[model samples]
Target: MGALALLAGCGLPRSGPTRGEIFNGSVLREGDAFVLVVTDRVNAIASVAPALGFSSEFRDAGLVGSDIISPGDVLGLTIWENVSDGLLVPTGQNATVLEEVQVDGQGFIYVPYAGRIRAAGNTPERVRQIITDRLGDQTPDPQVQVRRVAGDGATVSVVGAVGAQGIYAIERPTRTLSQMLARAGGVAVDPEIARVTVTRGGHTGSVWFEDLYEPGHDIALRNNDRVIVEADTRAFTAIGATGAQSRVNFESQSISAIEAIAQVGGLNPSLADPEGVFVLRNEPEEIAEQLTGQDLVGTQRIVYLLDLTRPNGLFFARDFAVRDGDTIYVTEAPFTRINKAVSALTGTLGGVNAVSSAAQQIAGN
Candidate 1:
């Protein structure tokens, strides 16, 4: 009888610790975690400030003239003179073509008798005027035309989650963020959830792909600018007695707690505790301070509770904002453990009755 009692009362297997077990271990005994009841008031508060944008330094670097020349740019020069025998013109041809003149490291280019002329920081037309003035003393009635033949000038690299990754020249069409992304063949990921980041000098700025056309986000491209297109990586983990235990990625710019639950197929109907839905995350100090009404330093571990059995519970969950790196857990129902215990007890009783019957049969034989 004692052995049977021990066998029947043994602990049953559970997917995870129940709600009471977690509260007793972390809240009541350890006192390391704080539990906040999820309500309309709590849902209204922003858990933590999001880092979803760029600073003024990036926004202030607005649009600039896209045709300005830079060092290392390849210039194409075609020179024509009125006289057939005039200088810079070929003997048989009426014009002289300098197909590939490279801008020197010091922002100057040598043009035969024109000597070292400044080309960088000047438009192609401005450089043409400078060359025409320089050659007028030697060549009579000189006509000069200059155009950027190949991009070595102001260029930005487009990489990460784009259709084609390469160095693109910051030309007139590809001067802004949206234009540049189009020049790079658009983002490989969905534009709604994609992110575009521009890193210039020591400062880095980012904005959503869909927001790149917004006023301040469509900043001008600069020399050596690195533009990266990527998808949103923020996600929350769904565990415990929910339909599935998996890390679910954020589907949009923002996700509500109820939506997160639905992503993991919602709570398991048979085993889930309707009153034990919890979201665990390290909340910022300001929020923790507001909840506890105390001065707290650094981030605090918070376990937010949501009871779906209440009248306003679903509405509160709908309003709750689920943040990145949060863990949503749904505990098993209390009666599940009781059912497991009763099932074990019934099996034990059946075995005992069978054994007693066999013993009686043997004694009678």
Candidate 2:
């Protein structure tokens, strides 16, 4: 009875989850709130992906036409008339020069004979036509020319992690995003880990520098657009039985779980349980709903399980997208903890034997 009681009392150490027990099919069936997935190449990639769509920020950047003028733009006007002693247009002088007429806060420019003309929101060419029409009868065949000298409205400010940081004027009708970055003295951060942000009209959007390598990603820039280039803060943590338990910054925006694991020095071969590979992430409510077939309220902290012992495990790992702030954990093998406990017990027993032997020798003396 005593022996049976001893065995029964030490039935199990309900400490933490064992290697076999965690991330298994049974966990999903147990009606646990957390989501567990058997990662497949197709589904793994689909799981971490947020519904990505083309940005509307630079939609009009592709539009070909004259650059539109805005408030705070400096305009230079030159007027010429055939008749002598003209009121607004000088005949004796080559042209009546109105150098640096800054566009007002109300988006209007003061012309000598044309009164306050709506110059903002219209191209320089459009403004010239409006002014010429207004002063047609007053001056004989009035020839007007409009030029942009210096203006905050016709320029963009490039700030953060750049060689040169200042307002860059759009001298030409259109400047591509790449061209603007080059003019601003290129990006300071590694191109792979850099993120470019554009803010305009109270709306903002960002894209990784790696995206610029694509054909159409190098979109054009508009007047008064604020472009910021900064180092990417997105990172993932590798913990547990992995070779290195540290935070790893993404070199590129999208990296497969396989690449991430490799970058962190693949799992500890001796200690890691191949079946216990897991990724913990706070999944968005929408994603949780799609995975579990139920609407998840608030932040759904989901744990994704990957069985690397399976045949297609490597392929799944390659396809799985590791997201920012994700925790990649490779649980220790069952035997590893048991071996450690045994070693501690052996060391304790050896110390006790050495003490007993020394005491026996002293008693004999």
lDDT top scorer: 1
What is the TM-score (0 to 1) of candidate 2?
A: 0.81
Question: Lowest summed-lDDT stretch of 10 residues in model 2?
Answer: 7-16
List candidate 2 stretches off by more than 4 Å. 1-17, 20-37, 41-48, 51-54, 61-70, 78-86, 89-100, 145-149, 213-216
Per residue, candidate 2 scores C-alpha lDDT tens digits across 1-365 of 45434432343332335545453424356534474655563364345565222376575555423467889888999988777788775556757898889999989999987899998878889999998898887877889999988764467899998889999776563376777888888899888778888887777777776677577677777777899999988899998778788999988868877888898889888778888888877777777676666666876767777778888887777778888888888887776666555555667689999999999999999
Candidate 2's error at 325, in angstroms? 1.2
| Residue 68 CA displacement from its true place in model 1, Å | 3.0
Give each model's whole-structure lDDT. 0.85, 0.75
Which residue pairs come into collision in candidate 1? none
lDDT digits (tens) for residues 1-365 of candidate 1: 45545643466777777887678756547768888788777776654447578788776776656787888889999999988787778788899899999988888999988999998878898999998998899978799999998765678999999989999888888888789889889999988889888899988888998887766667778888899988999999999888899998888988888899999999899889989999998988988888767788999888889999999999888888899899999999977766777777788889999999999999999
- Compared with the true structure, model 1 gives a TM-score of 0.81
